[model samples]
Target: MRLGIIIGSVRDGRFGEGVAQWFIPLAQESAAAAGDEVSIEVIDLKDFDLPVLTSATVPGAANKQYVDERVQRWSAAIDACDGFVFITPEYNHGVPGGFKNAFDSLGSEWAEKPVAFVSYGAEKGIRSVEHWRAIVSNFHMVDVRTQLAFSVFEDVDEQGSVAPTDSHADRARALVGDLISITGRLVTTR
Candidate 1:
């Protein structure tokens, strides 16, 4: 199984990178323990610089025929993954606009895939994760309930770095395990 860990924040000093850096290795370890051949990759939203939804056709009907080069690349990247882990930051009790735009730019690529969330912010980004659940449902994506959230006040340091607790590591393992298990079952249907 190929898993894409999407860094959904693109701010200049976003904390999502730190979270991804911490989570990736742990996820790999969990996959190894599960005895599944999972290949993981980081899909940074910053690399794509995707524009807001501007194509003439709706994403679901576009058939992956996006005119924008960046969107096309984004589509290809998402299409290659069997499942995803979205590392996001909460902005004003919701998901970052750029992240939501990046998500809206794809359709069938996300269909039937499993997804997990790891979010950070004032409220541990739980509200953002909750909002994401409704949006991903539009693509019929299966979102795992085992999420890992980090509070800005508690899980971050003075240098604006992530300082996850030991318990967070256990949550990461459980999230990855659930994602892998669900992806294994769902990928067959796709």
Candidate 2:
């Protein structure tokens, strides 16, 4: 199974990158321990360069047909993943605009897949996770309840560095475990 760890932030000095860097190894270790052949990859939104939704066709009806090459590549990447872990940052108590646009750029690629969340911001970015739950439901995606959330004030320092505690590591492992378990089941159905 391929697990895509999507770095949802694209800002110049985004904290989500640090979060992904820290979480990837833990997720890999967890997947290994789960005895599942899971390959984890970073799917950074920064690499996609997706524009705001400007397509004449609604993404749900696009059938993976996109005019722009970038969107096509993004669709292929997303289509290859069996599950996802979205590392998101809350901006103004909501999901980041770029990530949302990137998500909107594709449709069926995300359908019926499992997704987990690792978010950071005020209140540990739970608001962003909550917002994501509603949005991803449109694709009938399974949003795992076990999630890892980080507080900007508590988990980050002045240098924009992330310092996750052992407790955070524990949560990450649990999230990965649940995602893998669900993905395994979903893949069989698919």
Candidate 3:
């Protein structure tokens, strides 16, 4: 299965990239151990500079008429993936505006796909996850209940690097394993 590790933060000096870097290899190893052939791709929101929603037509699971080229590109990427792992940072107890905007840009590509989250922040970014859970459900995406939440103060090192300990790896393994299992079933059915 093609799994997208979407970097959900676009802020300067964001910690999302480091978390993503740490999680990718762990996910790969876990999937390999499970005898699942999975391809992990990093989809950074920064690459697609999707503007905030200003369209008259509301984007939904059935609507795919995106006027912007960037939106189109983002949509295509999502369409190619069988599942997703979102690396998110909490901003004011919610998801980053850019990450939310990227989702708003296009629609339907996420339907019936499995999504997991690896979030890091002061509060482990659980609030962001809560917000995303409610939102992604609108697109009919199945979310894995097993998620990895990294506390910035605990999981991240003083040098601003994601220095995950053994426990973190175990959590990632569970999350990735669940993602692979769920995606495998969903991909075949979809």
Instruction: Kindly list the per-residue Cα lDDT of model 3 for residues 45-88, writing each as its tens digit.
Output: 89988878787777774366678777878888988899999998
Candidate-wise lDDT, in order = 0.91, 0.92, 0.86
lDDT of 1 by residue, 105-126 (tens): 9889999898999998888999
How do the residues 1-190 of candidate 2 rate in per-residue lDDT, one tens digit apiece? 9999999999998778889888999988987887757888889999988878998999999999999999999999999999999999998888999999999899999999999999998788999999999999999999999999998788876776888788999899899999999999999998
- Score candidate 3 by lDDT: 0.86
RMSD for each of the candidates = 1.2, 1.2, 1.6
Full ranking by lDDT: 2, 1, 3
Q: Tell me the deviation in Å of residue 72 in model 3.
A: 0.8
| Clash pairs for candidate 1 | none
Output the worst ten-in-a-row residue range by lDDT, candidate 1.
156-165
Which whole-number lDDT from 0 to 100 does residue 82 have in model 3?
96
Specify the highest-lDDT model's number.
2
Indicate the residue-level lDDT of 175 in model 2: 95
Worst 10 residues of 3 by lDDT: 56-65
